[model samples]
Target chain A: MARVVVDVMPKPEILDPQGKAVTGALQRLGFAGLAVRQGKRFEIEVDGEVTDERLDEIRRAAETLLANTVIETFAVSVETQEQAAAQGQPA
Target chain B: MARVVVDVMPKPEILDPQGKAVTGALQRLGFAGLAVRQGKRFEIEVDGEVTDERLDEIRRAAETLLANTVIETFAVSVETQEQAAAQGQPA
Candidate 1:
Protein backbone atom coordinates (compact mmCIF):
# COMPACT_ATOMS: atom_id res chain seq x y z
CA MET A 1 0.00 0.00 0.00
CA ALA A 2 1.04 3.56 -0.62
CA ARG A 3 0.21 6.80 1.19
CA VAL A 4 -0.48 9.97 -0.75
CA VAL A 5 -0.58 13.25 1.13
CA VAL A 6 -2.04 16.21 -0.76
CA ASP A 7 -2.68 19.76 0.32
CA VAL A 8 -4.98 22.12 -1.59
CA MET A 9 -4.98 25.72 -0.60
CA PRO A 10 -7.17 28.54 -1.82
CA LYS A 11 -5.70 30.99 -4.26
CA PRO A 12 -3.77 33.49 -2.17
CA GLU A 13 -5.69 36.39 -3.67
CA ILE A 14 -9.08 34.82 -3.15
CA LEU A 15 -10.89 35.30 0.12
CA ASP A 16 -10.98 32.27 2.38
CA PRO A 17 -14.07 32.62 4.46
CA GLN A 18 -13.04 29.76 6.70
CA GLY A 19 -9.53 30.99 7.12
CA LYS A 20 -10.81 34.43 7.99
CA ALA A 21 -13.11 32.98 10.60
CA VAL A 22 -10.31 31.04 12.23
CA THR A 23 -8.09 34.08 12.28
CA GLY A 24 -10.80 36.10 13.95
CA ALA A 25 -11.44 33.47 16.57
CA LEU A 26 -7.78 33.10 17.36
CA GLN A 27 -7.63 36.74 18.21
CA ARG A 28 -10.65 36.48 20.47
CA LEU A 29 -9.45 33.28 22.12
CA GLY A 30 -6.26 34.93 23.32
CA PHE A 31 -4.22 33.62 20.44
CA ALA A 32 -3.79 37.07 18.99
CA GLY A 33 -0.02 36.70 18.88
CA LEU A 34 -0.11 34.19 16.06
CA ALA A 35 -1.23 33.95 12.43
CA VAL A 36 -2.93 31.05 10.77
CA ARG A 37 -2.91 29.55 7.29
CA GLN A 38 -5.52 27.12 6.06
CA GLY A 39 -5.09 24.18 3.70
CA LYS A 40 -6.28 20.60 3.17
CA ARG A 41 -4.93 17.07 2.93
CA PHE A 42 -6.23 13.94 1.34
CA GLU A 43 -4.60 10.75 2.73
CA ILE A 44 -5.15 8.14 0.10
CA GLU A 45 -4.18 4.49 0.26
CA VAL A 46 -3.77 3.03 -3.17
CA ASP A 47 -2.91 -0.54 -4.07
CA GLY A 48 0.22 -1.37 -6.09
CA GLU A 49 3.55 0.28 -6.55
CA VAL A 50 3.32 4.05 -7.16
CA THR A 51 5.90 4.88 -9.78
CA ASP A 52 7.25 8.43 -9.77
CA GLU A 53 5.60 9.08 -13.13
CA ARG A 54 2.30 7.67 -11.89
CA LEU A 55 2.53 9.81 -8.78
CA ASP A 56 3.03 12.89 -10.92
CA GLU A 57 -0.10 12.02 -12.82
CA ILE A 58 -1.99 11.82 -9.53
CA ARG A 59 -0.64 15.20 -8.53
CA ARG A 60 -1.88 16.65 -11.78
CA ALA A 61 -5.31 15.22 -11.20
CA ALA A 62 -5.38 16.76 -7.70
CA GLU A 63 -4.09 20.08 -8.99
CA THR A 64 -6.83 20.22 -11.58
CA LEU A 65 -9.70 19.32 -9.27
CA LEU A 66 -8.68 20.08 -5.68
CA ALA A 67 -7.08 23.41 -6.44
CA ASN A 68 -7.68 26.45 -8.53
CA THR A 69 -4.55 26.74 -10.64
CA VAL A 70 -5.63 30.24 -11.49
CA ILE A 71 -4.82 31.32 -7.96
CA GLU A 72 -4.41 28.34 -5.64
CA THR A 73 -1.38 26.09 -5.20
CA PHE A 74 -1.16 22.44 -4.17
CA ALA A 75 1.31 19.60 -3.67
CA VAL A 76 1.32 15.83 -3.48
CA SER A 77 3.83 13.20 -2.31
CA VAL A 78 3.83 9.43 -2.52
CA GLU A 79 5.72 7.12 -0.19
CA THR A 80 5.78 3.52 0.91
CA GLN A 81 5.41 2.12 4.42
CA GLU A 82 9.16 1.95 4.86
CA GLN A 83 9.59 5.50 3.65
CA ALA A 84 6.89 6.72 5.99
CA ALA A 85 8.52 4.88 8.89
CA ALA A 86 11.85 6.42 8.05
CA GLN A 87 10.17 9.77 8.21
CA GLY A 88 9.10 9.02 11.80
CA GLN A 89 5.55 8.09 10.95
CA PRO A 90 3.89 4.74 11.43
CA ALA A 91 3.97 2.23 8.64
CA MET B 1 4.13 23.86 19.93
CA ALA B 2 0.88 22.33 18.70
CA ARG B 3 0.10 20.51 15.48
CA VAL B 4 -3.62 20.45 14.83
CA VAL B 5 -5.02 18.19 12.12
CA VAL B 6 -8.40 19.18 10.78
CA ASP B 7 -10.44 17.53 8.07
CA VAL B 8 -13.20 19.54 6.43
CA MET B 9 -15.16 17.41 4.04
CA PRO B 10 -17.88 18.57 1.73
CA LYS B 11 -21.41 17.52 2.62
CA PRO B 12 -22.14 14.00 1.54
CA GLU B 13 -24.71 15.23 -0.96
CA ILE B 14 -22.54 17.96 -2.35
CA LEU B 15 -20.63 17.06 -5.44
CA ASP B 16 -16.91 16.80 -4.75
CA PRO B 17 -15.41 17.84 -8.04
CA GLN B 18 -11.93 17.12 -6.71
CA GLY B 19 -12.88 13.78 -5.27
CA LYS B 20 -14.59 12.76 -8.47
CA ALA B 21 -11.58 13.63 -10.54
CA VAL B 22 -9.33 11.62 -8.24
CA THR B 23 -11.61 8.63 -8.49
CA GLY B 24 -11.42 8.74 -12.23
CA ALA B 25 -7.66 9.00 -12.15
CA LEU B 26 -7.30 6.14 -9.70
CA GLN B 27 -9.36 3.90 -11.91
CA ARG B 28 -7.44 4.92 -14.97
CA LEU B 29 -4.23 4.28 -13.11
CA GLY B 30 -5.27 0.66 -12.59
CA PHE B 31 -6.75 1.22 -9.14
CA ALA B 32 -10.19 0.24 -10.33
CA GLY B 33 -11.14 -1.52 -7.12
CA LEU B 34 -10.87 1.60 -4.99
CA ALA B 35 -12.97 4.60 -4.00
CA VAL B 36 -11.80 8.08 -3.07
CA ARG B 37 -12.82 10.96 -0.83
CA GLN B 38 -11.18 14.38 -0.57
CA GLY B 39 -10.72 16.61 2.49
CA LYS B 40 -8.56 19.43 3.86
CA ARG B 41 -6.19 19.67 6.84
CA PHE B 42 -4.88 22.51 8.94
CA GLU B 43 -1.52 22.19 10.71
CA ILE B 44 -1.17 24.94 13.26
CA GLU B 45 1.76 25.41 15.60
CA VAL B 46 1.00 27.59 18.57
CA ASP B 47 3.22 28.34 21.53
CA GLY B 48 2.25 27.75 25.18
CA GLU B 49 0.45 25.02 27.00
CA VAL B 50 -2.65 23.68 25.28
CA THR B 51 -5.09 23.02 28.03
CA ASP B 52 -8.11 20.92 27.15
CA GLU B 53 -10.39 23.94 27.31
CA ARG B 54 -8.14 25.99 25.11
CA LEU B 55 -8.12 23.19 22.59
CA ASP B 56 -11.92 23.17 22.56
CA GLU B 57 -11.94 26.86 21.84
CA ILE B 58 -9.65 26.23 18.91
CA ARG B 59 -11.86 23.46 17.62
CA ARG B 60 -14.86 25.76 17.75
CA ALA B 61 -12.94 28.38 15.85
CA ALA B 62 -12.03 25.82 13.24
CA GLU B 63 -15.60 24.61 12.96
CA THR B 64 -16.95 28.08 12.37
CA LEU B 65 -14.40 28.77 9.63
CA LEU B 66 -12.92 25.56 8.29
CA ALA B 67 -16.03 23.44 8.42
CA ASN B 68 -19.58 23.87 7.26
CA THR B 69 -21.68 22.69 10.15
CA VAL B 70 -24.72 22.77 7.94
CA ILE B 71 -23.56 20.37 5.28
CA GLU B 72 -19.90 19.54 5.85
CA THR B 73 -18.24 17.77 8.78
CA PHE B 74 -14.90 17.92 10.58
CA ALA B 75 -12.90 16.63 13.52
CA VAL B 76 -9.95 18.09 15.49
CA SER B 77 -7.50 16.65 18.01
CA VAL B 78 -4.76 18.21 20.15
CA GLU B 79 -1.70 16.45 21.51
CA THR B 80 1.73 17.16 22.84
CA GLN B 81 4.95 15.68 21.49
CA GLU B 82 4.67 12.98 24.08
CA GLN B 83 1.16 12.03 23.04
CA ALA B 84 2.02 12.20 19.36
CA ALA B 85 5.06 10.00 19.87
CA ALA B 86 3.00 7.60 21.92
CA GLN B 87 0.79 7.33 18.89
CA GLY B 88 3.89 6.44 16.84
CA GLN B 89 4.62 9.84 15.28
CA PRO B 90 7.67 11.93 16.03
CA ALA B 91 6.64 14.80 18.16
Candidate 2:
Protein backbone atom coordinates (compact mmCIF):
# COMPACT_ATOMS: atom_id res chain seq x y z
CA MET A 1 0.00 0.00 0.00
CA ALA A 2 1.07 3.54 -0.72
CA ARG A 3 0.85 6.08 2.07
CA VAL A 4 0.04 9.71 1.37
CA VAL A 5 0.71 12.39 3.91
CA VAL A 6 -1.35 15.55 4.17
CA ASP A 7 -0.12 18.37 6.33
CA VAL A 8 -2.48 21.15 7.34
CA MET A 9 -0.89 24.22 8.88
CA PRO A 10 -2.27 27.51 10.01
CA LYS A 11 -1.57 30.39 7.67
CA PRO A 12 1.47 32.45 8.46
CA GLU A 13 -0.71 35.42 9.32
CA ILE A 14 -2.88 33.39 11.64
CA LEU A 15 -2.31 33.23 15.35
CA ASP A 16 -1.78 29.74 16.74
CA PRO A 17 -2.66 29.69 20.40
CA GLN A 18 -1.70 26.06 20.87
CA GLY A 19 1.74 26.72 19.50
CA LYS A 20 2.07 29.79 21.64
CA ALA A 21 1.12 27.84 24.75
CA VAL A 22 3.68 25.19 23.95
CA THR A 23 6.34 27.80 23.35
CA GLY A 24 5.60 29.38 26.68
CA ALA A 25 5.62 26.02 28.41
CA LEU A 26 8.92 25.07 26.82
CA GLN A 27 10.50 28.34 27.96
CA ARG A 28 9.20 27.81 31.46
CA LEU A 29 10.69 24.31 31.34
CA GLY A 30 14.08 25.86 30.41
CA PHE A 31 14.10 25.12 26.69
CA ALA A 32 14.93 28.44 25.11
CA GLY A 33 15.48 30.05 21.73
CA LEU A 34 12.74 28.08 20.12
CA ALA A 35 9.58 29.18 18.36
CA VAL A 36 6.93 26.62 17.56
CA ARG A 37 3.90 26.30 15.29
CA GLN A 38 1.52 23.40 15.57
CA GLY A 39 -0.34 21.77 12.74
CA LYS A 40 -2.14 18.58 11.73
CA ARG A 41 -0.80 15.54 9.96
CA PHE A 42 -2.87 12.92 8.24
CA GLU A 43 -1.49 9.67 6.94
CA ILE A 44 -3.69 8.05 4.33
CA GLU A 45 -3.00 4.52 3.28
CA VAL A 46 -4.07 3.86 -0.28
CA ASP A 47 -4.76 0.37 -1.53
CA GLY A 48 -2.96 0.80 -4.85
CA GLU A 49 -0.01 2.52 -6.49
CA VAL A 50 0.22 6.29 -6.09
CA THR A 51 0.09 7.87 -9.50
CA ASP A 52 0.13 11.56 -10.36
CA GLU A 53 -3.61 11.40 -10.81
CA ARG A 54 -3.98 9.85 -7.38
CA LEU A 55 -1.80 12.57 -5.93
CA ASP A 56 -4.03 15.17 -7.52
CA GLU A 57 -7.02 13.52 -5.98
CA ILE A 58 -5.37 13.52 -2.60
CA ARG A 59 -4.49 17.17 -3.02
CA ARG A 60 -8.08 17.94 -3.78
CA ALA A 61 -9.12 16.02 -0.70
CA ALA A 62 -6.65 18.02 1.34
CA GLU A 63 -8.00 21.27 0.01
CA THR A 64 -11.59 20.33 0.41
CA LEU A 65 -11.69 18.50 3.71
CA LEU A 66 -8.36 18.49 5.48
CA ALA A 67 -7.62 22.18 5.57
CA ASN A 68 -9.56 25.27 6.46
CA THR A 69 -8.65 27.35 3.45
CA VAL A 70 -9.57 30.62 5.10
CA ILE A 71 -7.01 30.22 7.83
CA GLU A 72 -4.93 27.20 6.93
CA THR A 73 -2.97 25.68 4.03
CA PHE A 74 -2.28 22.07 3.17
CA ALA A 75 0.42 20.11 1.43
CA VAL A 76 0.19 16.57 0.18
CA SER A 77 3.09 14.20 -0.38
CA VAL A 78 3.59 10.49 -0.86
CA GLU A 79 5.55 8.73 1.87
CA THR A 80 8.34 6.70 0.34
CA GLN A 81 9.29 3.20 1.39
CA GLU A 82 12.55 4.45 2.83
CA GLN A 83 10.70 6.90 5.03
CA ALA A 84 8.28 4.21 6.15
CA ALA A 85 11.15 1.95 7.12
CA ALA A 86 12.86 4.78 8.95
CA GLN A 87 9.65 5.30 10.94
CA GLY A 88 9.51 1.58 11.76
CA GLN A 89 6.34 1.20 9.73
CA PRO A 90 5.69 -1.76 7.46
CA ALA A 91 6.53 -1.05 3.88
CA MET B 1 17.53 30.10 11.62
CA ALA B 2 17.14 26.37 11.42
CA ARG B 3 13.83 24.51 11.42
CA VAL B 4 13.10 21.21 13.10
CA VAL B 5 10.02 19.17 12.35
CA VAL B 6 8.44 16.94 14.97
CA ASP B 7 5.71 14.59 13.93
CA VAL B 8 3.55 12.91 16.59
CA MET B 9 1.31 10.05 15.60
CA PRO B 10 -1.09 7.85 17.55
CA LYS B 11 0.23 4.42 18.40
CA PRO B 12 -0.65 1.84 15.76
CA GLU B 13 -2.89 -0.05 18.15
CA ILE B 14 -4.66 3.01 19.49
CA LEU B 15 -8.12 3.92 18.31
CA ASP B 16 -8.08 7.03 16.09
CA PRO B 17 -11.65 8.22 16.03
CA GLN B 18 -10.81 11.45 14.24
CA GLY B 19 -9.07 9.54 11.49
CA LYS B 20 -11.90 7.07 11.28
CA ALA B 21 -14.42 9.87 10.98
CA VAL B 22 -12.38 11.44 8.23
CA THR B 23 -12.17 8.12 6.45
CA GLY B 24 -15.92 7.71 6.59
CA ALA B 25 -16.44 11.25 5.39
CA LEU B 26 -14.11 10.66 2.46
CA GLN B 27 -15.97 7.53 1.49
CA ARG B 28 -19.26 9.34 1.65
CA LEU B 29 -17.75 12.04 -0.50
CA GLY B 30 -16.81 9.41 -3.11
CA PHE B 31 -13.15 9.07 -2.20
CA ALA B 32 -12.55 5.36 -1.67
CA GLY B 33 -9.96 2.76 -0.80
CA LEU B 34 -8.14 5.02 1.65
CA ALA B 35 -7.56 4.62 5.36
CA VAL B 36 -6.39 7.60 7.38
CA ARG B 37 -4.68 8.11 10.70
CA GLN B 38 -4.40 11.61 12.13
CA GLY B 39 -1.50 13.11 14.01
CA LYS B 40 0.20 16.33 15.05
CA ARG B 41 3.07 18.22 13.45
CA PHE B 42 5.21 20.81 15.14
CA GLU B 43 7.51 23.19 13.32
CA ILE B 44 10.16 24.66 15.55
CA GLU B 45 12.41 27.49 14.54
CA VAL B 46 15.75 27.61 16.28
CA ASP B 47 17.68 30.84 16.61
CA GLY B 48 21.06 29.27 15.88
CA GLU B 49 22.71 26.43 14.03
CA VAL B 50 21.41 22.95 14.72
CA THR B 51 24.11 20.80 16.30
CA ASP B 52 23.94 17.21 17.52
CA GLU B 53 23.51 18.45 21.07
CA ARG B 54 20.73 20.76 19.95
CA LEU B 55 18.99 17.89 18.23
CA ASP B 56 19.19 15.84 21.37
CA GLU B 57 17.70 18.73 23.29
CA ILE B 58 14.88 18.97 20.77
CA ARG B 59 14.31 15.26 21.05
CA ARG B 60 14.04 15.64 24.78
CA ALA B 61 11.60 18.47 24.38
CA ALA B 62 9.53 16.38 22.01
CA GLU B 63 9.48 13.47 24.39
CA THR B 64 8.64 15.55 27.41
CA LEU B 65 6.14 17.97 25.94
CA LEU B 66 5.23 17.40 22.32
CA ALA B 67 4.19 13.80 22.55
CA ASN B 68 2.18 11.73 24.96
CA THR B 69 4.59 8.81 25.24
CA VAL B 70 1.87 6.49 26.42
CA ILE B 71 -0.21 6.63 23.24
CA GLU B 72 1.79 8.64 20.73
CA THR B 73 5.13 8.25 18.96
CA PHE B 74 7.10 11.16 17.67
CA ALA B 75 9.93 11.63 15.18
CA VAL B 76 12.18 14.63 14.93
CA SER B 77 13.93 15.77 11.75
CA VAL B 78 15.52 18.91 10.45
CA GLU B 79 13.78 20.62 7.59
CA THR B 80 16.20 21.09 4.74
CA GLN B 81 16.26 24.19 2.56
CA GLU B 82 14.88 22.27 -0.39
CA GLN B 83 11.90 21.08 1.59
CA ALA B 84 11.19 24.56 2.88
CA ALA B 85 11.25 25.94 -0.65
CA ALA B 86 8.98 23.16 -1.86
CA GLN B 87 6.55 23.94 0.94
CA GLY B 88 6.69 27.67 0.13
CA GLN B 89 8.10 28.45 3.56
CA PRO B 90 10.86 31.00 3.99
CA ALA B 91 14.23 29.31 4.25
Candidate 3:
Protein backbone atom coordinates (compact mmCIF):
# COMPACT_ATOMS: atom_id res chain seq x y z
CA MET A 1 0.00 0.00 0.00
CA ALA A 2 1.03 3.56 -0.65
CA ARG A 3 0.74 6.09 2.13
CA VAL A 4 0.03 9.67 1.21
CA VAL A 5 0.63 12.35 3.80
CA VAL A 6 -1.13 15.68 3.58
CA ASP A 7 -0.03 18.50 5.85
CA VAL A 8 -2.43 21.37 6.27
CA MET A 9 -0.96 24.52 7.80
CA PRO A 10 -2.49 27.85 8.57
CA LYS A 11 -1.67 30.80 6.36
CA PRO A 12 0.97 33.07 7.79
CA GLU A 13 -1.63 35.79 8.17
CA ILE A 14 -4.03 33.67 10.14
CA LEU A 15 -3.98 33.50 13.90
CA ASP A 16 -3.25 30.07 15.32
CA PRO A 17 -4.39 30.00 18.89
CA GLN A 18 -3.62 26.31 19.32
CA GLY A 19 -0.11 26.94 18.16
CA LYS A 20 0.16 29.85 20.53
CA ALA A 21 -1.02 27.68 23.37
CA VAL A 22 1.58 25.11 22.57
CA THR A 23 4.23 27.80 22.43
CA GLY A 24 3.17 28.99 25.81
CA ALA A 25 3.29 25.50 27.20
CA LEU A 26 6.71 25.00 25.71
CA GLN A 27 7.94 28.17 27.30
CA ARG A 28 6.46 27.14 30.61
CA LEU A 29 8.21 23.81 30.20
CA GLY A 30 11.55 25.63 29.74
CA PHE A 31 11.89 24.96 26.04
CA ALA A 32 13.21 27.81 23.96
CA GLY A 33 12.41 28.52 20.31
CA LEU A 34 11.35 31.27 17.97
CA ALA A 35 7.73 30.24 17.50
CA VAL A 36 5.38 27.29 17.06
CA ARG A 37 2.60 26.68 14.54
CA GLN A 38 0.18 23.79 14.89
CA GLY A 39 -1.34 22.04 11.92
CA LYS A 40 -3.02 18.82 10.73
CA ARG A 41 -1.53 15.80 9.07
CA PHE A 42 -3.60 13.18 7.32
CA GLU A 43 -2.22 9.79 6.41
CA ILE A 44 -4.18 8.11 3.66
CA GLU A 45 -3.32 4.54 2.79
CA VAL A 46 -4.35 3.50 -0.70
CA ASP A 47 -4.09 0.29 -2.59
CA GLY A 48 -1.63 -0.04 -5.47
CA GLU A 49 0.79 2.60 -6.60
CA VAL A 50 0.16 6.29 -6.13
CA THR A 51 0.10 7.37 -9.74
CA ASP A 52 -0.09 10.96 -10.93
CA GLU A 53 -3.85 10.60 -11.30
CA ARG A 54 -4.12 9.21 -7.77
CA LEU A 55 -2.07 12.05 -6.41
CA ASP A 56 -4.25 14.54 -8.22
CA GLU A 57 -7.34 12.95 -6.74
CA ILE A 58 -5.78 13.03 -3.27
CA ARG A 59 -4.93 16.69 -3.68
CA ARG A 60 -8.51 17.40 -4.55
CA ALA A 61 -9.58 15.55 -1.43
CA ALA A 62 -7.09 17.57 0.57
CA GLU A 63 -8.46 20.80 -0.77
CA THR A 64 -12.06 19.90 -0.27
CA LEU A 65 -12.23 18.11 3.07
CA LEU A 66 -8.77 17.92 4.63
CA ALA A 67 -8.07 21.60 4.73
CA ASN A 68 -9.72 24.94 5.26
CA THR A 69 -8.32 26.45 2.10
CA VAL A 70 -9.60 29.88 3.02
CA ILE A 71 -7.03 30.08 5.82
CA GLU A 72 -4.73 27.14 5.22
CA THR A 73 -2.25 25.82 2.68
CA PHE A 74 -1.22 22.20 2.30
CA ALA A 75 1.60 20.08 0.97
CA VAL A 76 1.63 16.40 0.05
CA SER A 77 4.14 13.59 0.32
CA VAL A 78 3.99 9.90 -0.46
CA GLU A 79 5.48 7.19 1.71
CA THR A 80 5.72 3.45 1.37
CA GLN A 81 7.07 0.76 3.64
CA GLU A 82 9.77 -0.19 1.16
CA GLN A 83 10.87 3.37 0.73
CA ALA A 84 10.87 3.94 4.46
CA ALA A 85 12.95 0.85 5.02
CA ALA A 86 15.37 1.96 2.29
CA GLN A 87 15.75 5.30 4.01
CA GLY A 88 16.24 3.66 7.43
CA GLN A 89 12.93 5.22 8.49
CA PRO A 90 10.29 3.34 10.38
CA ALA A 91 6.90 2.95 8.77
CA MET B 1 16.33 29.82 11.47
CA ALA B 2 15.54 26.14 11.44
CA ARG B 3 12.11 24.54 11.21
CA VAL B 4 11.38 21.45 13.24
CA VAL B 5 8.36 19.35 12.29
CA VAL B 6 6.80 17.06 14.86
CA ASP B 7 4.21 14.59 13.66
CA VAL B 8 2.03 12.96 16.32
CA MET B 9 -0.11 10.00 15.35
CA PRO B 10 -2.48 7.78 17.26
CA LYS B 11 -1.42 4.31 18.28
CA PRO B 12 -2.43 1.56 15.92
CA GLU B 13 -4.98 0.20 18.38
CA ILE B 14 -6.63 3.55 19.03
CA LEU B 15 -9.75 4.63 17.20
CA ASP B 16 -9.45 7.62 14.90
CA PRO B 17 -12.92 8.99 14.32
CA GLN B 18 -11.62 12.13 12.59
CA GLY B 19 -9.70 10.04 10.14
CA LYS B 20 -12.66 7.76 9.52
CA ALA B 21 -14.86 10.78 8.89
CA VAL B 22 -12.41 12.15 6.38
CA THR B 23 -12.16 8.81 4.64
CA GLY B 24 -15.94 8.63 4.43
CA ALA B 25 -16.05 12.15 3.04
CA LEU B 26 -13.47 11.31 0.39
CA GLN B 27 -15.40 8.25 -0.70
CA ARG B 28 -18.55 10.34 -0.90
CA LEU B 29 -16.59 12.85 -2.94
CA GLY B 30 -15.84 10.06 -5.42
CA PHE B 31 -12.26 9.60 -4.31
CA ALA B 32 -11.12 6.11 -3.44
CA GLY B 33 -8.62 5.23 -0.73
CA LEU B 34 -7.93 2.39 1.64
CA ALA B 35 -7.98 4.26 4.93
CA VAL B 36 -7.16 7.59 6.53
CA ARG B 37 -5.35 8.33 9.80
CA GLN B 38 -5.52 11.84 11.16
CA GLY B 39 -2.75 13.36 13.23
CA LYS B 40 -1.19 16.58 14.40
CA ARG B 41 1.84 18.39 13.06
CA PHE B 42 3.69 21.09 14.87
CA GLU B 43 6.01 23.49 13.04
CA ILE B 44 8.55 25.03 15.35
CA GLU B 45 10.95 27.69 14.16
CA VAL B 46 14.09 27.97 16.22
CA ASP B 47 16.95 30.34 15.97
CA GLY B 48 20.47 29.11 15.15
CA GLU B 49 21.38 25.56 14.36
CA VAL B 50 19.30 22.64 15.60
CA THR B 51 21.96 20.88 17.62
CA ASP B 52 21.49 17.37 18.95
CA GLU B 53 20.74 18.87 22.33
CA ARG B 54 18.12 21.14 20.87
CA LEU B 55 16.55 18.23 19.04
CA ASP B 56 16.39 16.32 22.27
CA GLU B 57 14.69 19.27 23.91
CA ILE B 58 12.19 19.42 21.08
CA ARG B 59 11.52 15.74 21.46
CA ARG B 60 10.83 16.33 25.10
CA ALA B 61 8.44 19.10 24.16
CA ALA B 62 6.75 16.79 21.73
CA GLU B 63 6.29 14.14 24.37
CA THR B 64 5.11 16.58 26.98
CA LEU B 65 2.97 19.10 25.14
CA LEU B 66 2.67 17.87 21.57
CA ALA B 67 1.58 14.31 22.15
CA ASN B 68 -0.33 12.13 24.49
CA THR B 69 2.28 9.42 24.68
CA VAL B 70 -0.18 6.93 26.10
CA ILE B 71 -2.05 6.64 22.84
CA GLU B 72 0.18 8.44 20.36
CA THR B 73 3.55 8.25 18.69
CA PHE B 74 5.60 11.08 17.27
CA ALA B 75 8.44 11.69 14.84
CA VAL B 76 10.50 14.80 14.36
CA SER B 77 12.32 16.33 11.38
CA VAL B 78 14.38 19.46 10.94
CA GLU B 79 14.13 21.68 7.89
CA THR B 80 16.13 24.66 6.84
CA GLN B 81 15.08 27.30 4.33
CA GLU B 82 18.28 26.93 2.37
CA GLN B 83 17.83 23.19 2.21
CA ALA B 84 14.23 23.56 1.08
CA ALA B 85 15.28 26.02 -1.62
CA ALA B 86 18.06 23.68 -2.69
CA GLN B 87 15.57 20.87 -3.02
CA GLY B 88 13.18 23.17 -4.92
CA GLN B 89 10.67 22.75 -2.13
CA PRO B 90 8.57 25.57 -0.81
CA ALA B 91 9.41 26.82 2.68
Q: Evaluated with TM-score, which candidate comes out highest?
A: 2
After TM-score superposition, what is the CA distance of residue B18 in candidate 2 from its true location, in Å? 0.8
lDDT of each model, Cα atoms only? 0.61, 0.87, 0.80
Give all TM-scores, in the order shown.
0.54, 0.95, 0.89
* CA RMSD (A), model 1: 7.9
Clashing pairs in 2: none
Per-residue lDDT value at A80 in model 3: 69
Q: Estimate the overall C-alpha local distance difference test score of candidate 2.
A: 0.87
At residue B89, candidate 2 shows an lDDT of: 35
Tens-digit lDDT track of model 3 for B34-91: 5899999888888888999888888888888888888888888887676434322221
State the weakest 10-residue window (summed lDDT) of model 3 chain B. B82-91
Worst 10-residue stretch by lDDT in candidate 3 chain A?
A82-91
Q: Which stretches of candidate 2 lie over 4 Å from their true place?
A: A89-91, B89-91
Query: What is candidate 2's lDDT per residue for A15-86, written digit by digit as tens?
Result: 999999999999999999999999999999998999988888888788778888889877788899888666
Instruction: Report the Cα RMSD per candidate.
Output: 7.9, 2.6, 3.1
Q: Model 1, residue B25: what's the lDDT?
A: 75
Q: For every candidate, what share of the true interface contacts is present?
A: 0.26, 0.61, 0.66
Error of 3 at B1 (Å): 0.9
Lowest-lDDT window of 10 residues in candidate 2 chain B? B82-91
- Superposed Cα RMSD, model 2: 2.6
